[model samples]
Target: MQSVGKPTGSLDPKRHLWVLGLLAPASALLPSQLVTHTGLAFFWWIGPIIVLIVIPTLDRLIGDDGTNPRDEDYERLSNDRYYRWCTYLFLPIQLIGLIIASAMWAGDDLSLADKFGLAATLGFVSGIGINAAHELGHRVEHLERWLAKVALAQSGYGHFFVEHNRGHHVRVATPEDPASARLGESLWEFLPRSVIGGFRSAVALERERLGRLGKRWFDPRNHILQAWAMTLALFATLTLLFGPQVLPWLLLQAVIGAALLETVNYVEHYGLLRERRANGLYRRCSARDSWNSDRLVTNVFLFHLQRHSDHHANPGRRYQTLRSSAQAPQLPAGYATMIVLAAIPPLWRSVMDKRVLAHYEGDITKANVLPRKRRRLLAVRRAVA
Candidate 1:
């Protein structure tokens, strides 16, 4: 395999920009350094600031990037070790940030507001770390799969490794999938369902799989157990090193981080559903079922996770090789903007409900919808018709 990462006739112009992804984990350290020198408390919240404000603005100014490699270029791009290092480097830097944050949280001379800001910073990093984990988790390599769980440890969402690849991918875009958002479902309403539902689904899936492998539910071979064990070990070590005072900040950051990931989930497949077959099985997922964005800045920051339509269509494809499909539904803005919108239910419905309805040609029945709101929505449509 000759180097496809760089060649005179290389296809990917943004290959060097992939390094921008390090900004996410590096955020925890950068803000801390800035605050240390400048004494500006606002810098403590840099991670969220980068996400909520910076990325969205950049998406507007920089605009979309629909570039995709040729089909013939897929294998070389996918196996490029350079791309693998980008994700592999994330885990260690992420852990280093958490350790530094823990030390600061335990004894730093920061005010309460500043401490919370630091926690939010760490939370955003941990949350984004899950996206990195997601890309790795889809790979067939044993090391990448294990690295996915390690990346998830800071957020206490190690079960995501078990649930997302095994559970969410299979059931996505269905009423039965907890991760898929329904029409008229608020983000607040979807949060607990996705969280608890994902956990329960992972447990059940692991139990069933272990039964076949002649292993107990508690067996270390269970991926969920293994992932959670890493989280437990991480937490215990942090507590011992930094003292119990760091625990609350750790927990706060984990919650914030998990929420960040879930907000992405809420935005990704909101009101999108797969059609069922005559045999009662759902149709295989296509790009049509997931919302997509091609904002160059966000795509680079997120490791092309925003090119989600192609991701579901090719789960094992590296982010470098994931293509944007014309068949997929498009989001009005990058996920950074959408995640903020998802938090405000009324505003969210105003922007997204019509889009959902249009996707199914105004047929509410075709959309995955909230059962309680179904009748009212249908009635409104009929009266307007």
Candidate 2:
């Protein structure tokens, strides 16, 4: 929980920048070729094998970067063209990767196992596709924002462009925020609420924006609709070019991508709440409101997204400049590890509930417990007392 003034790491981020591109070809080439050449079906599970198994293992082995960049270095880091181009390169790589994977699906003579491998690998692309979009979506430039939509179009979840920036960031950690997971709610229960509810929130947010402009909900300037329209167009073209066989992979990959995003949302503020004053206004978000991780490998791949507190507090800051905080609720492991652990409700609850309680000093009611679990949580608190 100790805070460092600057980020510390031995890895030269400039040299390892290509690590972000590793995901581009994961689905497009690696798995199927490895399977076909080796004649082993084990490679079929490479997607989960890489995301759930490999990354988490490496995260533990390599540990985290805890030091912040020096105060003087912030200006140079912020102005670095290398970091900007890294995100800009995302558009072609993911777009081409998707096309290549679809071509493989259409032309390759492969087994169901091969198809599954492709879908899973593409799912990882879908997940990282949105991750890249997230970094760009926070930018103010018109081109960067358009590229955000394009990146999201790859995953068919373009509404995130609107909802995340306008809604989730504004209402986060409140009961009203779909992206914020409630305590005692399992990941299974949270996923549908977050996905379906998040989309609805996006539309509502768009309606409100258009209303302010004296435009109808269907106005072309309605960013939510515009983003979705782009997604529909892309999907239509992909289906037309690749035929129906590609539909299942496309849909499954989108689902995996969305699920991955919601899982991250679930952990970022699970059981945390912003205090409301007697006047009925919640306190502004701070480091304490969100969970943070500093694991180095995943942080680099994710563009330092694990530094959630700073990102939320200063959404305009470039990822390369995001700093770690001492006050935020710290995760026991890196994001990849936490995301996997979240899939199992019992283990997730067992591991995280105690931390939540400790954060609140055993005051159960001060935290955001699920409605159904309130009485039980209170009873447990009394028993412990």
Best by TM-score: 1
Candidate 1 Cα outliers beyond 4 Å, as residue runs: 1-9
Per-candidate TM equals 0.96, 0.94
Candidate 1 weakest lDDT stretch, 10 residues: 1-10
Please list the residue runs of candidate 2 whose C-alpha ends up more than 4 Å from where it truly belongs after superposition.
1-15, 18-27
lDDT of each: 0.90, 0.82
CA shift of 347, model 2, Å: 0.5
Score residue 363 of candidate 1 by CA lDDT: 87
Q: What is the lDDT for 161 in model 1?
A: 91
Largest lDDT belongs to which candidate? 1
TM value for model 2 = 0.94
lDDT (10s digit) by residue, model 2, range 20-77: 6556434455766787799887776676777788889988898877667656677887
